[model samples]
Target: MSDTYRALTRKYRPTSFEDIVSQDHVSNTIKNAIKQNRLSHAYMFCGPRGVGKTTMARVLARTINEIDSSIDGESLNQTLNIVEMDAASNNKVDDVHHLRESVRIPPQNGKYKVFIVDEVHMLSKAAFNALLKTLEEPPEHAIFIFATTEPHKVLPTILSRVQRFDFKRISVDEIVQRLRKISLDEDISIDEESLHVIAKKADGALRDALGLMDQAIAFCGDTITHNELLQALNVVGTDRLFEFMECVKDHDADRGLELINTLLQEGYDIQEYLIGLTEHLRNLYIAHETSKLYLVEASEETKKRYQQTAGDFSRDDLMRMLHIISEAQIKLKDASQPRIQFEITLLKLIHMERSEQLSELLAGLQELKKNSGNFVAPSQNGSTQKEVKPEPEEQAEKVSEPVDETESTEENLEPQPLNPSTDSEAVGSDGSSPGPKESEIEVEAEAEVDTQIEEEEDDDFDIGAPALITTLARKARASVQSEKQKQTAPSNGAPTETSSEKDLPEKITTEYVQEIWVEYLESLKGDFPMLLHLQMERTKVKKVKGGELHLECDNSFAQKMLDEQSTDLQFKLKEFTGSVLRFNISVGEIDEKDKPMSVYERFKQIQQKDPIIRDIVEIFGAELEY
Candidate 1:
């Protein structure tokens, strides 16, 4: 190493506020404080490393003492009164005590004594406590500036005593500009792309950026190229990134996996590769999302390349790729076989489009199945075709034909409810109260109506177009009543009756209904499979009172489904119970703990009550955090 050699970080470190990039806020505040002589005795500088935290503290020390223009670089660092302490090394209670003892002494030459402590958060609990009192009430001539990456780790007591200035990360443009200026001033030959690579490698740390540039210059001799800088830094090339993305676009998982193996063979970090891929996908997503390139932090050529590839993917496909990579990265930490896990996740991306297509096809089939049951669907080649128009004039004539006394044409205008407990008992035309004989006549009439309706129903029927079905059902019900009157019209001026309750099942009850419910559910399993997701597995038959059986479901959604299917469900129940039982469905309250709260539901509740949070939601387009 040459004796006169100096690292670029030390040589080009900002000496004045104007020289610091992207730190106008910090610089402006400190300048006003020093100029006005209103500086705090204890001040805290907090931010990420190499964003002018320590450098700002040093500049403040010299400027406050009015020695900034007089002191040279090497001598300024070794000055007596302007003491700089590395808190990482001298963080014990004794070191703090010794400093505390020395704080009482006045400056030998300068008007003020300045002590700058860097990484002050590294001090022990005892050291902080010992320094707290001194920090609160320091000597008038002594100015203490504490610099820390983590201001939160410092005691609140210490923080309260000092005026804290929080520094922000320098922007990429600013960092790049700084690197360019340094390269020009130092007579180094490097392209803009190489400087950007160094700036990105620095990650907002100007010290790190200059250090990287110094290393690049040393390695490349004089002219630093992008490829040499990438090799020197051991980062994967843009070519590899593009190639990997192309493999995905072509849906070639085998080639992608081979590329991954090659990267591993070259001793590249899996995590780096994963991050690089995620960033590339993010750039592509941005390109697809907007016409503006403000958000993208890459060269014009790189942006054009991303733009070219961006159209090759949809937003959904890009989001899926991002999700897969993010999940893999999270799982990669605890994974014993990280490489295998990565391979699986990448292969999942390759197969994602096909899987989504299959999902859509299955969904369509399910929807068709649901609606097909409601209609007499068309057959291929117009097979099973039927023209359901019967002769209207003949039907009207038959309807207008008067019936003889032997067969009563009494039309039951309003159909009686088919509830076993209170079904209308067929009475005589003379207004005789209904008895077992009348009930038997009604039962026989209903059976005949069922058979007649079945023979007329054809494949052209549409339930959604319900005019025909509704008319048919009404006509079937009217025919039953007319038949009931015929049976009870009295043969030879005397009504005839048949066998009664012995032909049907005895007494309908809630207990009997409950017994057959499980069997009914089992029958439904072949049809409405979505009902299996229902939480109300144990629906209770509350009672059979007032002509209706009351059933209670534990969930409102389940109750609604049951109510909608009540006609079909009650039919099944009656087939087992042997009675025309009516039903009233209700939802009962379940335990609050049993009904688990979702984060979204809670967020909705909160949003309803808190208008400020609602406004924040509207302003930011923020969703509920899980």
Candidate 2:
């Protein structure tokens, strides 16, 4: 042995453009440009750190000057034509002024003088301004290469002037291949699993992989394995990640929490663990969605494992779990006990149920459409009827009232035909059903809501009724809208709305509007209690005459939010009252002497308003904090 050692990053760094891994598009383009003498005055290499940005810049610098880029050859950095500056440390007007002066001098040794500015985004505003003129029109003998991890921070003027090359995050298999090649070249004995562990830990950074491999070699001697590399790197094992996911999939909160305890004992950072677990879940989700093992970037065994377990989670379940975990992650930073916070989050994920109400409705609708062709012609009495075959659970939940799956809480809502008609009735003068209008559907939706309210167990403030009512109203509106779209498409591009939709009831009363408004507010309070309290609680129905219902908002803010939701609200109202009415939002005027406040604020205001309190404060010379 020569008894000479070098860091793997430097020892195996690509010298030529061809040797650059996983960035063939960049390398080929640069090579073609160089060979064809079609070079830009300034080039920008931007991407994530340790992805061969600075290295590529140096290669370009050498290639332009006809110098060897190999590490074994004379160091390319030593060439007089190439000037590499760390922009982060020297990012000021004076530094850029010096650069401008230097660019003026002609290259003595090479065709061009290459100035590589690493971390170019860190350049100060004044420095960027100073650089702009030169960058826009640089000297013929000077070439500028700027590299940054964040291209977004770079000025548009500077960005527009330069040729930008985006480097991709190297793939895991590519990193593993590179690591294995280096290990073999150095005569190191490491298992394939160990190489995989290093690659996974690198997270698409090839330089990180090399440094990790070097560290592994330094600590683990010539012979290394997966456990040793993981230990050396202080990284959590792949087993824990797979096991934790299994616990989540199984809804075994205890086991999931036990993993947390183990992580704590092992001194793994909680947030870091959460991030890794999230990534692991994402991989499983991808495997589930794509069914491509290669896309997962895991070992064949791990990919197989993911493919097997991925079926346990539907896309909605995975999305819900991700949301729960992300929320916990954000909340964890402020939490006094991170372990407890994460545990609760995991528990939330474990207990989460997918809300497939909309999905079920869509499925039911599609199934109805498919089976509509199988419907037999009407009986002699001229009435057509079709039966739906739902799952056993839905079949068992039969009640006196018909169940519309779109509004079903426990069962998948199934779509029932509004007008199962005879041929004559179906083919109307306009070739559409004239009977059982949207108003009839509204009645069915109301019945569904009433049944849902009756089924719910609630001792606190009749919330169930209002909530189910609003939900049913919204679902009925969707169904009605969908049916309307399909049936009422006009030949002349005019909507074939019913006369009731176009003309309002001639004599609508304020008392009736108030009643409807109260129910609407109740529905709001049921579904969005916080929002109701914040914006809609104090709204007053100003008038309910003609074709419009004018409502008074507390302020302009309430008017704005409610204005955005006006269409949906109008649809709900039309469904609720069986009448089409336009909703208009207006800010209400408060009495100049009467200050508006919340209940708590009003109680404090009352104390300030009392004359006795003022007198007592004056007599005692006491100050009170409310």
Candidate 3:
């Protein structure tokens, strides 16, 4: 007869409390209970599959029944008193009655009779009720132990009667350590990286680790490398997945799609590949913020890879990618062609750019303020102050003194004028030299003071009008342009010129046309928020062209919404502008660079010949949709 090989997982199954891996707390607690003579009549163990819950239960049975422990040549045989049942297949009321009857009589030789039921939650309601009476009040010598992966499905009455212990998922490190020991004892040669892969593939299950290791050894002829492990499990390695993620981050859609196609050609499951990629990204996210990378349950090399990859992405980008992948997962299941779904999802990820961080936006604003000199400091009177310094020539002209002719005139005045001299003498007194008059000096001082005050007031008004308008326009334009760039930059650098042109109308400033468009937009006050908001932001009157009034909005959604309500909008605009204006909606995002100066600034800059936007800034803070 030919000898058969036992699987490593079954051959190395935990037989004693000390042999169970990654479950010291549970095993130690059970051991102490036995030692203290405080064992419960009914015990429940619940956790994920292969975490040693059932194994612990079996060990408990053997311990209580006093079965021989001869694995390590330490025999402690006393008597057999434990019976095990698979409740999944035998969940009938009759089965429960049979079990109850069997537990009635005491063990033939042992002190306690133990019954171990695996998957106890699978028992039908009738079976559970049938077993309840015996479970609640069993004989002093009887013990009932139940194990289940899902404890919520178990009857509450049965649960209330039993002492429950919840089990935890094993860490990857624990699984790796157990596999290393097995490899050593079994004389199988495998690299640390291969062991890491197997452990991760096991996903917090020691038994699963053993099983995978057994399979790896068998398939790879006793020596397993990282590549061998990957082939055996069909896993795309961490490095390739990270490369794919990098491509996505860089907006390289072609490269990302190529990677997906390559993996699919390698016989990997599309869904499983996506799921693994999602997990890889999640780990990277966790690693980005944490110094304790080891706690992520990856090998040293894998942890390093994660840390390096995490440095390439912002947290927001990683989160966005995770969301996209998750949504793709749902769509792929019912998709007509799963591969196409994956391709489309990959393209989306690769072409996706992270939204500008609010910090970056604020920083840009600060930079613009520094460049444009728009910041105004508040004055003592609570009004804003603007400092102005005149040119050297202008200053010289302002502070120059008037000629001093008063002294000359006084020298020419005759002494007879003091004694009320003749009329001829008084009239001829200043003929040779004129004397200064008090009224003339006073008039000159008052005129100079008035001129200085007027100049100061004009400077303040000049800064206030144009500066305020320019500041508002620049901000509005920057916000709109940034958003537009984000939306269009990933689409091969093609600007949305068509959409921009469609939203702008030519020569729509005539009073008749202006009134018509205003009435049209106002009519949509209740019907469309986007149109209303757009109108609120737009105040300039563009000249009408081809009987159409053009207006700009911040985004495409607003543009589309306005387009849908064009007819009603056109009629109202005609009424307000006094022209039969058709609608030409220009969805041009703001151009920060081309924004005109404020009205006040423009007036001051008449010498500079800079034109100002000829309208008030429209302010609409309310939420609107078009």
Candidate 4:
């Protein structure tokens, strides 16, 4: 061994334009310029850090001056024709003055004197002004190439004088391909997952990826695995992200907290973890909603994992999770306790609500309406009334009773004068029937109100009964009071039962209770999303016995939420089922199949069930939207 080490970034740096990755536009243009002899006097290479700006500047310098770019060649520093300067350190007015003087001299060996100024934006204002004169009137044998990450910092006049070539950030696939080539050349053994991890961790910077690969080689001695790479780089793998999301899907806040703690213990940066997490969620969203698996830059196994897990979360949940993570990332910069912030973020994701789709809501509404025939609103006297459509016999009896009472009252009323001065005026000046009897008028009014109520019930099915209850109460108050008076009459007769008492379910069953349970949940989604999540989605109907309804929840968070809303939930339950059933809620075991399905999984199920939906999904690439 020579005991000499050249880092992979420098060793594998692209020497020819063909070797440069993902910058074909710039490379191709430059090659054409070189071939056609259309080279500008000065060129500016601009892009992000570590994105081949300086490298391209040097390559252009060598290419234009007819110097060999082979790594085995003698150093270019020996030639007076090609010069490289670090403008970051040599950016004073005096440096530019010296450069101006050097430009006056002809090339010593090459066709032109090429000056490659890295970080040229660091040049001072006076230095740029000094350079402007030399650039405006450059020698025939001199060429200038300036490279900078921030091109805006260069004076606009200086920018206008130079031809600019923007280098794009290398794609993950290109970086991975380059890294694989390097690994093979260097005789290093690394798995595809390891390469993917390094490529993604590079974040479009090939130099950073090479640096990480060198670090991994030094740490792992050529045989690199994904786990070792993660350990060496101090990065949390996507497996950790998968685990965290699994915790979220299961609603296991404890596991979520533990994951955060484990990451902290492993010496992983929370900010980096959050960045990786955001990308992972993005990948999951892409995998869930689209067929473009190539968009996810990962190994086959990881991509499959992403696809499988993508079904465990809805797009809304993913979006919210991403939002939470982004907020945490921002807050972490100013947070007094970063770990706590991260913990809180994870907990929020774990306890986050699953979004209800509009179609699901509409379906639920339809089901509620379809089942509303069995539903009843509670009466004003704290009693339940079944919303039954009155039988034809009952309708006939009601109208006939009112008419009979009206006729009897009319027969009893003596004939009176027309009373033209009063509000009531007799017809035809006859005064034979007087204007109308008070009891007959009352019967007519009662009959009219009854007809209107029956018509309303027949049409809308009393879905808005609660909202209209007060109005209906005012209209029926007279009839109710009259019925009460008859009921209170001091006679040794048997008491009559009300409609509520007669229509109440003789015994509550699990099936009816579940139907009411579903209806109650549907009612919450529109008005109380949070309540629906807490009390509805996570709770299961364990059993319904008599007046006691036992419910089992998977976690304490849901149990606590249910407990807090127990009173209102029980009331709603009774209202929907027409039985005063009490909730016996307990935090206990729940079946996995009964758990809430993610958006993609639900859509998949729907697609499987409906051929039209399946065809639409296949034809139009339709995704389940929130």
- How does each model score on lDDT? 0.70, 0.71, 0.67, 0.74
Instruction: Kindly report which residue stretches of model 4 are placed more than 4 angstroms away from their true locations once superposed.
Output: 1-3, 69-74, 357-626
**What is the lDDT for 228 in model 1?**
83
- lDDT of candidate 2? 0.71
Candidate 2 segments exceeding 4 Å error? 69-74, 249-254, 351-626
User: Candidate 2 residues 129-241, lDDT tens each?
Assistant: 99999999998889999999999999999999999999999999999898888878888999877888888888899999988888898889999977877778888777888
Give one digit per residue, the lDDT tens place, for model 3 in 206-276.
Answer: 87888888778778977788887899888878878888988976888778878887898899998888888
Cα error of candidate 1 at position 93, Å: 2.0
Model 3, C-alpha of 79: deviation from truth (Å): 8.1
Q: State in Å the error of residue 549, model 3.
A: 50
Please give the distance, in angstroms, between residue 296's alpha carbon in candidate 3 and its true position after superposition. 2.0
Number of the top TM-score candidate = 4
Against the hidden reference, what TM-scores do the models get? 0.59, 0.55, 0.58, 0.62
lDDT string, candidate 1, 1-626, tens digits = 34498888777766777887888998998899777978889889999988998888877777766776656444565776788888999999999998888789988777888888989999999999999889888899998989999988998889888989998988777888898887777777888777777877788888888888878878887788888887888777777888987888788988988988888888788888888888888888898866666688777778788889988876556776887888789999999998898788777776666334444454344434543433454689874433333246534433433323233224422244444764444556777644434343444444444334444445434332221222444455545446545745666867454333233447766676566667655544312322321322457778988779887876554565566666655765554666666779887886876553343455676788999998988899876211
Candidate 4, residue 165: the lDDT equals 87
Off by over 4 Å in 3: 1-3, 71-80, 355-626
> How does model 1 score by TM-score?
0.59
> Candidate 3 overall Cα lDDT vs. reference?
0.67
**Residue 221 C-alpha lDDT in model 3:** 72
Ranking by lDDT: 4, 2, 1, 3
* Preferred candidate (lDDT higher): 2 or 4: 4
Clashes of each: 2, 3, 36, 0
Error of 3 at 194 (Å): 1.4
